[model samples]
Target chain A: MINIGVDLGGTTIKMALINEEGKMIDKWVIATNTIDNGKHIASEISKSILKKIRQFGLETSSVHGVGVGAPGFINLDTGFIYQAVNIGWKDYPFKAELEQLLGLPVIVDNDANMAALGEMWLGAGQGTRNLICVTLGTGVGAGIICDGKILHGVSGMAGEIGHITVIPRDGAACNCGKTGCLETVSSATGIRRMALDALDYIDSESILRTMFETKGDITAEDVFDCAERQDPLSSTVTEKAAYYLGYALGALAVTVNPEKIVIGGGVSHAGDALVKPLKKYFRHFSLPKIADSCSIDLAKLGNDAGVFGAAWLCMQK
Target chain B: MINIGVDLGGTTIKMALINEEGKMIDKWVIATNTIDNGKHIASEISKSILKKIRQFGLETSSVHGVGVGAPGFINLDTGFIYQAVNIGWKDYPFKAELEQLLGLPVIVDNDANMAALGEMWLGAGQGTRNLICVTLGTGVGAGIICDGKILHGVSGMAGEIGHITVIPRDGAACNCGKTGCLETVSSATGIRRMALDALDYIDSESILRTMFETKGDITAEDVFDCAERQDPLSSTVTEKAAYYLGYALGALAVTVNPEKIVIGGGVSHAGDALVKPLKKYFRHFSLPKIADSCSIDLAKLGNDAGVFGAAWLCMQK
Candidate 1:
């Protein structure tokens, strides 16, 4: 049987039809509108799925169910988007609306959680019962699987590793209104911000200065590139960010002690450049046994993780 | 039938005989000689258990099994003490030794993990599947329960909350050679140390100085008393410690999203003096829905949690 998978994001909605084997038989992407008129957006999502099904010459009856992965807090029981800041959604009955439009069974969960489920089923953590997936995008997103089950906690808000207090007393302010969250040091935007902050303190004899002048904006990529080119200031900034990110990961390891931690997202593109430093400092900060047993690896499946995981969720029930 | 429970600590070994109803039918305590041979300590524990059983009028055949709780890292699968610094134990086959002397099945686990299990089965978390137990004494210890099962990650070190870094950088040195560990800011020793450190910068008066002079040592109790009396310095120290601790709990809630958090240990005795501030800061730092559903309550089992949980462990399998 096939399942319909939807990857709901702030700017776009990606829909796919996946078979029991998790292969995407058909797919399409549509621009997402976050306006209060969610009915229009709901219709758009339905149309996207139906169009893909028709194009692939697949019968509607062949689909088993629909699974959605939304970016932000979701009530798994109610399928409610409790709050998604990026999409300006709050207490929205997402599943009800989508089901109303499509006339199908639907399960909705946190995006990172869905991605984690995907990894556990088909990606880096294929057979692992205890694993963690961390996505280092604009903001850090995490999914924790324990004993082969996703932990939704009491409010379905577990795996918010981004907000764990890396700097307790005083550090940079977070969008969560807290200071020194793990994301403030680990995310792509966080890395770029670190470079800009470092530019103020250190002499800017950096390749980043030249790149930024020409590119109009600096990215985490620019920072990593400059650091690799032996730019002292950029290396220091990247090292500092990696050090703290590792420290946060170390803290996370001590708390959950997952068997495998799969690091994903744009910044993970640096591969060993990011993970090497993370592993080094992670050991320094983590308990010896936990550090020794847990393996930190780059995430497989990339952006496809969301769609794959959503489909996997449908297959579960 | 009855079972024997032994809580092996660095300085004391507490043993109890528990009946089928989970009641302590008899109990005894003996000093532990850490510097002595391991077999001798095991013999003392066996002797203590026998004495407790004899006093309770229970025959050897009436005992189901033996359960022991030991501090520090433990291998649940092997029933070995991986490393226990204060107890001077490393890779010690304690359960095997105890079983040899007593001629009975023996089960062992980390002291805090078993304590939380004890609370989950018979105390504060009796009916809950997701609970976190934090013991705040000389050091902080945590035990996590998810979906009716204890979360003992791949290596049986899943709940090391004290070692997780609360502060990103430039915090106090932990005995484990790490900086900004939660134990450095939240333990009774941490709170008292904060009070002394704050005295160098602040000119606020405190009765704790005279109290400690006469008592020969200061403790979290003394700090709480001064805070209750509205001493500014003590209040600052306690509030700061509570805030950081609460912040970490808030961060932890986002990650674990537990149904309830049971606070135990000596410093927890400060009651509302600590909890009130902790709740305030926890809410400030946690995601809204998570902060609303999860609660911080005092551990009901007290020092007996270890014994009760140890007994319950044998009853389980």
Candidate 2:
């Protein structure tokens, strides 16, 4: 059977046509314009997905189901994206609209959750019944899978680990209008901000400053590169970010106690440069038993995780 | 059919014979001594349970299974209590020992988780599939239930909400060797500490001072009583404690997204004194959609929640 998986992001709509074994036969990426109406966007997604399926020489009737992964609060049972800040969506029935447009059943879920599901089926988390995936990029995203099932909480927001309060009283300003949220201290943005803060505290000439001076923006990636070269400032900033991130994961381990944690996204590309330090600090903070049960690894699927996870979802039923 | 449910605590072991519909047919409590060997204690429990069954005119063979709710890190699948701080237990297989003594199938789980499970099945959280039960006594205990099943993470250490870090960095000393845990700021002990802090910061002729001066120890109950009588110091302390507790719950809500949070134990007896203020602050700190999906209420089963939840566990498969 062929399943169509769509990953809807703020900037692009990526779709894949996959076989029963989760092998993507064909895929396409289209630039998404957020200014379009919800129905129009849904129609566009349908067209792109159909085009991809035809390009792959797959019959429409052969398609079992279509799954879409969105970046926000999505009610998995209801197939509604309650809210997606990046896309200006609020309680939009993307699944129903897309089903109408394509004349096929559609399943919708939070993108981060789908990514974790993808990893569980075909990436770093394969063969594990319990795992958590953390995506460290422009923003922090997390997905928790337990007992071979993705846990969709009462509001389908069971895996919002980024907002878990790591900083109790005060630390940094989070976009959620709260001070010292975990995202504020441990996300890619947080890591870059840490470098800027360290620059203010200590005068240092390094690769990060060069990037900021030239590109007008410094990312967590530039800091990782600098840290790899043994730059003290970048290393200190990245270490601090990893420390808090690990602490948050450690505390979360006490709460959720997953067997493995798969770290993904742009920042996770730094690999052990970030993970080794994170593992050290996570053990330092969590209870011995909980810390011992959890192991961290980088996500193996890269960009294909969305397609893999969304396909994995349809395959579950 | 009858099912024996036991709640094992430091000072006492409470047992009940629950009918299929969850009615308590017979109940008893016995003193539990830490000095007693685990095997002997298991024998005693089995004997007492048998005595109760005979007295209630129920045949021993009619009893389907035995369920035990214990404190500390437990292996639910293995029925082993790895650690119970209050009971001084370590790697004790109470289930296997008791099964040998009574010749009946036995199941064991974390006491707090069982309490939350009990509430989910028959108490305040009845009819709700996704619920979080928080027991706010000397320490904070939490049980997270999703999709009608207790989320017993990979290591059976899931739902240890008390140990989740609430403070951004570091604040007070916690029993878990970590500073600024949620229990440190939200439990009964936390309220007492906050009350003391308020007394030092605010200058006033307060009932709390008189009560504390007259009584050697200041209690959360005393502070609540003082606040009821319009003591400024007590109110400030309650507000401060409520604010942080609500903030932590709000952050937790974003991640867990439970449909309802059932609060129990000693401090929860304050009812609206805690819930009202907590709701106010939860709204201030929670992600908008998460806050909307969750409702905070008092747990109904009280001390019996453990046994009931354990009994419910028996009926599961």
DockQ (CA atoms), all models:
0.63, 0.59
lDDT of candidate 1 over A95-131, digit per residue (tens): 8998887777889998898888888888998878899
- Provide the overall lDDT of each model, using Cα atoms, as 2-decimal numbers: 0.84, 0.84
Clashing pairs counted in every model? 1, 4
DockQ winner: 1
The digit string of per-residue lDDT tens for model 2 on A1-317 reads 98878888888888888888878788889887677544468878888877776776778788888888888777787788878878888879878888988987888888998899999888999888889999988778788887887888887878777777666565788887777777886788898888888877887687777777898887888889989988888888888888888877877787788999999998898877899999998887677778888889999999889977888787666
- For model 1, the docking class works out as medium
lDDT of 1 by residue, B1-317 (tens): 88777888888988888876888877778998876544478887887777666676778888999888888778887788877877777778888888888888899988888889889888898888899999999999898988777888888888888887776569899877888888998999899888777765665556876676688777888899888998777788888888888877887898989989999999989888899999999888787777888888999989899989889888886
Candidate 2's C-alpha runs over 4 A off are: A20-22, A33-35, A38-63, A83-92, A100-104, A167-173, A194-204, B33-35, B60-62, B168-170, B193-205
